[model samples]
Target: MRFLLIVFMGGGLGSIARYLVNKWVGGTLTSVYPYGTFLVNIIGCFLIGFLIFFTQRAGASTIFWRLFLVTGFCGGFTTFSSFTFENVELIGNQQLLLFFVYATGSVVLGLLATYLGILAARNI
Candidate 1:
C-alpha cells in the first residue's frame, strides 16, 4: 500500500511537470513538429539513466526508488503514444520526409541523451 501510494504521488508530480514542460516548450517552438513530446521523452530517458547509475554507484537498492521514479514518474512523464500519433499524422499528411526525420531523430537523440546521463552520473 505504501509503495503504491509513493508511486501514485510520484506519477502525479511527474505528470504535472510533463504538462508544464509541454505548455512551455510547445508554446515557444516555431516548428510544427511535436517538440514537446520529443523533449519530454528525451529528458525522461536521460533522467532514468542518471537515476539508475547514481543509485547503483551509491550502493542503493533500487526496488522502491525504481518503482517510484522509473515505473511511475518516467512512465507518466514520457509520451510514447503522443510520439506515435505524431508520426502517424505526419505520414497520413504525406509528409514522409518529416515523419522519417522526426521518428529517427527522437530515437537517436533519446539514446544519446540516456548515454550522456549515464556518463554524467558515473563521473559524479
Candidate 2:
C-alpha cells in the first residue's frame, strides 16, 4: 500500500509534466512531427539514466526512489506507445520520409541523451 501510493504520486506528477510539455510544444511548433512525444521520451530516458547512476553512487538501497522516479514517473512520462501510433499515422498519410526521420532520430537521440545523462551523473 505504501509503495503503491508512492508510485501513484510520482506517476501523477509525471503525467502532469508530460501534459504540460505536450501543450507547450504543440503551441510552439506546428508540424507533422510529434515533437512533444519525442522530447518527452528523450528527457525521460536521460532522467532515468541519471537517477539510476546517481542513486547507485550514493551507496544505499534507495528502492523507494527507484520505484517512484524510474518505474512510476518514467513509465508515465515516456510515450513510446504514442510514438508508434504517430508513426503509423504518418505512414497512413504517406509521409514516409518524415516518418523515418522521426523514428530514427528519436531512437538515436534518446540513446545519446541517456548516455550523456549517465556521464553527467558520474562526473558529478
lDDT of 1 by residue, 15-68 (tens): 998999999997899788989878888888777766656766766566788778
- Give candidate 2's whole-model lDDT: 0.83
As a TM-score, model 1 comes out at 0.57
Model 2 worst lDDT run, 10 consecutive residues: 79-88
| Best by the TM-score measure | 2
| Cα distance off (Å), candidate 2, residue 7 | 0.8
Model 2 residue 22 CA deviation (Å) reads 0.5
Per-residue accuracy of model 2 over 69-97 as CA lDDT, tens digit each: 87678768875534665687799899999
Off by over 4 Å in 2: 79-124
TM-score (C-alpha, index-matched) for candidate 2: 0.61
Evaluate all candidate structures by whole-model CA lDDT and list the values in order: 0.80, 0.83
